[model samples]
Target: MKNIVILISGGGSNMAAIARAAQKEAWQEKRGLRIAAVISNQADAPGLALAKNLGLSTDVLSHKSFDSREAFDAALMACIDQHAPALVVLAGFMRILTPGFVQHYAGRLINIHPSLLPAFTGLNTHQRAIDAGCRVAGATVHQVTAELDHGAILAQAAVPVLPGDTAQTLAARVLTQEHLIFPQAVRSFF
Candidate 1:
């Protein structure tokens, strides 16, 4: 089976959504694909427990343990390669990947950003949108490249930015759309 390994650094809500979709859709039996593992850069990441609860293999290689970004990416790539991943999905993996690591995965790597990409491409995206008085904000699933969040768009879902919306409220709506479209993007690969 072609393995889809997910990397997460937080609660892994998106990771759970993709894992659930993979299980319910029987990706392995029908599409020759499966979620082989879930790896986290934080040893205590809550995602590890969530992934285990979903019955997917989990690993942790703390980025802090490494002295440099290059060292960390090298080790991370080694861990990921062990899973034989055909696709590597970054769902809340908060690190800025080294270009080498990005190139290693290349077309196989993908990410889900919180804001409509080509707009808010970095952290604090929701608040930025709200501050700018954007009437609409959404999520984008895209191919991974050396540039941060500027990758090729795969699938996107837009959510309206209502009046007096705080960042948290806006993020909640965007996350809901993320849960929906992320799984769809992954499924499209198979």
Candidate 2:
């Protein structure tokens, strides 16, 4: 089976979705793939508890404990490599990885972003999209690159921004889309 390791910094809805999808017979029997671990940067992240409840191995390597981003990433990579993951999924892993870290998992790493990408590449995407009067907003599943969200797009799901939509409303809509597409993209990789 192809083992996957998911990195998260918050509630891992996307990670859970992908795990559930992989559990299906179509994926487990037809394609040999599995979620091996869920690692978080924050020890108290609620997702760690969820992952434990689902019987998945979990780890928390606090960024504060490391001397540098490089040190933290090195430790993170070591923790992930212990499982020998065939792929690493970033499901809200908020930290910016160093170039060397990104290179180590090149082509085998993927991430889900709240914006359609190449439009709003960084934080505050929902507010920015609404402020810019974008009629349509969406989520993107892409390969993680050294250039942040500037990666090869694998998939996207567009959601309409209503005239009265607030950032919270927009975010909620986009999150639903994210949960759907992220799992599909992971399945495609398998």
Candidate 3:
């Protein structure tokens, strides 16, 4: 079976959702896909436990231990290469990867961003969208490129910015769409 490795830095709700979808969709039997591992740069990341509970191998290569961004990327690349991942999913992974590392993974790397992308590329997307008076806020699944959050979008799901919506509320709604679309986008890769 082809292997998929996921990277995360926090609670990994999207990772959990993808794991559930893989099982429910029988991706292993049907599409020859398996979640080979879940990795994090933070040792204290709660997603490690979630991945473990899902019976996936887990690894933590703390960025603090590395001398530089390149060093961390090299170690991370090594860890990921060991699995020979057919695809690498960034599920809330919070690091700005080196360009070399991004090139190494190239077309096989993908990420889910909180905004429609090309709009709010970096952080604080929800609040930025709210402040900009956007009527719709959404998520984008895109091929990972050296440029931050700028890549060929594979899929997107839009949610209306309801009246009186706070950033937290907007984030919550957008996250729901993220859960749905991420798994679908991953499946489409095969």
**Residue 115, candidate 2: alpha-carbon lDDT:** 96
Candidate whose lDDT is highest = 3
**Which ten-residue region of model 3 has the weakest summed lDDT?**
48-57
In model 1, the clashing pairs are: none
Rank list by lDDT: 3, 1, 2
- Candidate 2 deviant stretches above 4 angstroms: none
Would you estimate the TM-scores of all the predictions? 0.99, 0.97, 0.99
Task: Assess each prediction's global lDDT (C-alpha) against the native.
Answer: 0.95, 0.91, 0.95
Query: CA shift at 43, candidate 3, in angstroms?
Result: 1.0
In the range 20-139, model 3's lDDT, one tens digit per residue, is 999999999999999999999999999999999989899999999988999999999999999999999999999998999999999899999999988999999999999999999999
Alpha-carbon runs more than 4 Å astray in model 3 = none
Over the stretch 50-96, how does candidate 2's per-residue lDDT look in tens digits? 88877788989999999999999999999999989899999999999
lDDT of 1 at 185: 99
Supply every candidate's count of residue pairs whose N, Cα or C atoms clash at under 3 angstroms: 0, 0, 0
